[model samples]
Target: MSVALEVKNTYEDFILEKDILYFRVGEHGLVSFHGKNYHIKKRLNTEEIQKMTSDSSFFKVNTDCYVNTRKIQHIGDGKVYFEVRGSESKYTTITKLRQHRLKEIVLQQKGEA
Candidate 1:
């Protein structure tokens, strides 16, 4: 479930609608889709983003990140991991503390299916 978001930087506002794999905590708030990360210029944070996108298939995997569960290839070691756009061996992770919630979300979705 790719989502379209409006994000702003120091200079401009940009539309970022992509097949977001995951968001990693970084210098600019969150790093995402195909390495196209952005800090929302005091517009939004991780929690806000989660709330905004949850019904569209985003989940707060941990404190430091939110992930599009549909893109998750694996979850482990307090992290949710997935493939990047053009990489085989390379993947990304977001910190996960109470990892069981991830399982529950998957299970719940599967039940729906």
Candidate 2:
């Protein structure tokens, strides 16, 4: 059976909400948004991003980026990687670890975790 899940949280006067997005990636890689690509100061590894994903305080969209899910627009996957859409970026791909964590988060959001 298919279940639907929603993630919601409030931080520093900002309200974040995330809907479940599904996709599959073959190997892990980095992704940058259209405008923010230049400002990527540092990239978080899969393990670190995974931890962030479970915090309930952060949102995990793709391997390369962890948005508050509240900021997600959509999720898609190509032959090599998965992409997540935000307010500006057309797509963002996540890492392998975050991929697994995303599944767990979705399940948790559905109350199945």
Q: Candidate 1 — which pairs collide?
A: none
Model 1 Cα lDDT, one tens digit per residue, 28-92: 54444332342333345778555545645767655555566666666666655565454553344
Q: Against the unseen true structure, what C-alpha lDDT does each candidate score? A: 0.54, 0.40
Q: What TM-score does prediction 2 earn?
A: 0.32
What local lDDT does model 1 show for residue 32?
41
After superposition, candidate 2 runs with Cα above 4 Å error = 1-55, 60-64, 70-90
Residue 58 lDDT in model 2? 50
- Tally clashing residue pairs in candidate 1: 0
User: What range of 10 consecutive residues in model 2 has the weakest lDDT sum?
Assistant: 33-42
